[model samples]
Target: MDFQLSEQHEMLRKAIREFAEKEIAPLVEKMEETGEFPLEIRQKMGAVGLCGLVTSPEYGGNGMGFLARAIGIEEVSRVCAGLGIALQVHHMCCWPLETWGTEEQKKKYLPRLASGETFGVCSITEPSGGSDPMGMQTEARLEGDYWIVNGRKCFATNSHVSDIMIIVAKTGTDPKGRPAFSAFIVEPDFEGFSLGREEKKMGFKGASSGELVFNDCKVPKENLLGKEGEGLKIALATVNRVGRPGMASIGVGICYASLEEASKFAKERVLGGKPIANLQAIQFMLADMFALAEAARILNYRANWMMDQGMNCDTEMTLAKYVATENAFQCARLACEIHGGYSCISEYAVQRFLRDAWVAIPSGGTSQIAKIVLGRHVTKNF
Candidate 1:
């Protein structure tokens, strides 16, 4: 198989790299310190079409393929992961709408989302449910022409800023008397819809992460995202197909950034009257980092290709998210060690990279969850 990037891909990568370095890198320190959302920078990403890489042109997107979307995430993440995650969640939230929504639903929401006129968020995780979304307690009872939603969603990214939310809620009763879930498009202005306090996170300080509360929130029947009882299937499929790749690409970008920074420092820092680049220890560390980054890039691209080809890539996507995120954390930690005392300081960016690296492991799926998935794939044990 060909490994080289096409001319279009090359141009896209270069353009994103230039924008990220010039626009996002300079604000890293201040954004972290002030805990600001960088709305202006996000608006810039929208104007440049980064917000809708995989969306269709009819909906104000570029109608590009999945590889292009992966590339965009990688490039932006290399400079600022918090901003990368913000964009990634936005795109992930749009996928369900694009894939399952009726043409009318698409026409109504996709354009504004693609144009960045309306920011979006996904609400699946609840105060009681994190890894096991099947245990989610959010309920939306049908009442004539509308649905009254009553539940809470925690750890919701962009919850405070989003104009629209894709909420997963129980809509019917199953054979065992358990609630059957459904997906709904909830507007922020809907009465009884409110946001909880913003979370103070260990990283991704520039992005908003908060809780969403629904207290008898009323939504029109037209807002139902898909057929009732299909919410779990839709949520899992969307998460596996699009969310995993987006998150894996972010890890790849962080690995690349860590390696780049460490290499630059190694070339300049002299020890024993010679540059650290001349030492075998530094060379080995850099080599390991490069190998991991290359593997991650390949894994990410392959999963994205499978998606474009209409192939089931559950195993490969999980592997990509697992290995890439763990490798990124390792690379960041090593880079910090290589930087010595400066790594501990907030000004150098190494510390920030270290903190950001931890987010990848849990964002898509925990390492334990990935291993369980791999086991199921290999042994058919589940």
Candidate 2:
């Protein structure tokens, strides 16, 4: 694989970096203080093409593909991971729709999503179903011209801000007693659909992480995504491609941030009348941080590049998510240690990076789960 990024990608990176530094940086202080993201930022992102990366131009989307999307996410994340996460989740909401929705569904929703007229969310996690698809308690029953959906979806990002949602619920039991699932393009105006208690998370604070409550929510029959009993398939594919790559992008951004923070501190911080950069210990730490950051980036970029090439890289994406997130955590912790007592204080950005790193592990599915998938791949292939 060519290690060099295309001129288009480089230019894209420069554009995003400039936008994030100019627009997003000014808002980070407020978002960190209030845990409330500005809706205006989403609008601005759409204007800059961040919101339409995954979409086709036929539907008012840029259709740039995954690698470009990852770069955009990573650059945005380098300044504020929370906003980056919100953008990524918005793309996640777009993925199944474009991949599975009817042309009419595309025409109706894609333009709205592409333009950031409203945020889009994919809500599937439930109190009963942490990782197991069959454990989903959200049930949908087909009625005349609609489906009645009833249950709570937890940890749904953009819960408050989103007007469009890709909702997954169990529709029936299969012949083998497995819970069959279906996906829907639900709107906030749908009857019985409401926002539940918002979660006060330790990280990704301003992403509006919360619950999606559907109490006999009525969705039109035409809004169903893909074939019947394909919700699990849709969910899995989205998670494998859009979800995991997003996590990796955030991880890579954090890793790079950690490296920058650590390198700067080591160079400027004084110990025994000399800058800590004079010490071999500090040098080694910086070296490791740099190496790991680059490694994570290479892994994540390779996975997304493979995806853009139309290859099924489930195992590769899983590994990239695992390594990138875990390395991010480790690197952030090291950066924190380099900050010494200063790291514990809220004033330091490294502390925030550490918190966000921990949250990243569980966002796209936990690191433990990634290991299981990778372990299975190892056993099956090796």
Candidate 3:
């Protein structure tokens, strides 16, 4: 019932906002222009403890929890949606390692991931598609001292940049003849592993999305992430727990930025010898945007709070993800409409925000998929 952010959360939000405005705002234009990931900013993000918000302190992370992670992603996304998503997916990769890794695995990899010395990724979607994880064609077989993996995963964020990745592959058949999947930790330099071409996308200009190819990729037996045949659990739990909420935060950020941009432009833009802010139509548009953005934020924060409380929040996370992403797209569209002809011009950031808003739609899962998740929950509980 309480809606207020704690003093610590408030302070974290402010610090992240200031960091984005100072450190990242200046680079936004260049990133959009170049369509390249800013590798230089990785260490700076690490230095500020932004890389490991949900990771435990024992492994050199801040151990701030998921709410802090949402706040950080929101503030950064308010300035740059691409960067926000990059950081979010980065956390997506780290979640399995931190949550499911063994004690030795944690010590060996968590420190580097926490410090931003190495980037991490999790690849589940393969060339066939992402909708069915079990249907993925990637297969791994046990050898003498290693697992030889062969498959191709597509639409992976940070595919070109990540040093380590959690790879999901079919290990064998279940007792019922269903595919048995397992998760493994694979290094990019491993034999038969290669980075594939990057996909040119509609938005998220500065974030990298590409394919990963594995041809007899060798992974040590020690690198198995969890018990054999548990890949589906790891992937599903991660998407529900981390991935959906992360994308929702990005949507909230896009909506927030749209509101700000539309408001500023309306106030400064003159019409009938007065500001457009004085017009009833402009006022109505802004009001709608404000409501949507506020609602998205509340839903996002609520889901994250439930997560921090160790509750079953899969339904909440999906609802937030569905609503936030849909509303973000609507808000961005309105902001562009409010700008009129200027929205079509590349010179204005509204156009870019609009493009980025579209990308958020399918980042975690499509809105229809989210609805299916919520529908199942409703059918079961209601």
In candidate 2, which residue ranges exceed 4 Å CA deviation? none
* Clash tally for model 3: 0
Stretch of 10 with least lDDT, candidate 2: 127-136
TM-scores for the candidates? 0.97, 0.98, 0.98
Q: Each candidate: what lDDT?
A: 0.85, 0.91, 0.89
Q: For model 3, how does the per-residue alpha-carbon lDDT over 51-158 read when each residue is reduced to its tens digit?
A: 889789999889898999999999999999888888888888788998889998889888888888866787799878887787899999999999999989998888
| Model number with the top lDDT | 2
Q: Give the C-alpha lDDT of model 1.
A: 0.85
Candidate 3 ranges with C-alpha deviation above 4 Å:
none
User: Which whole-number lDDT from 0 to 100 does residue 319 have in model 2?
Assistant: 88
Q: Which candidate model has the greater lDDT, 1 or 3?
A: 3
Candidate 2 at residue 249, lDDT? 96
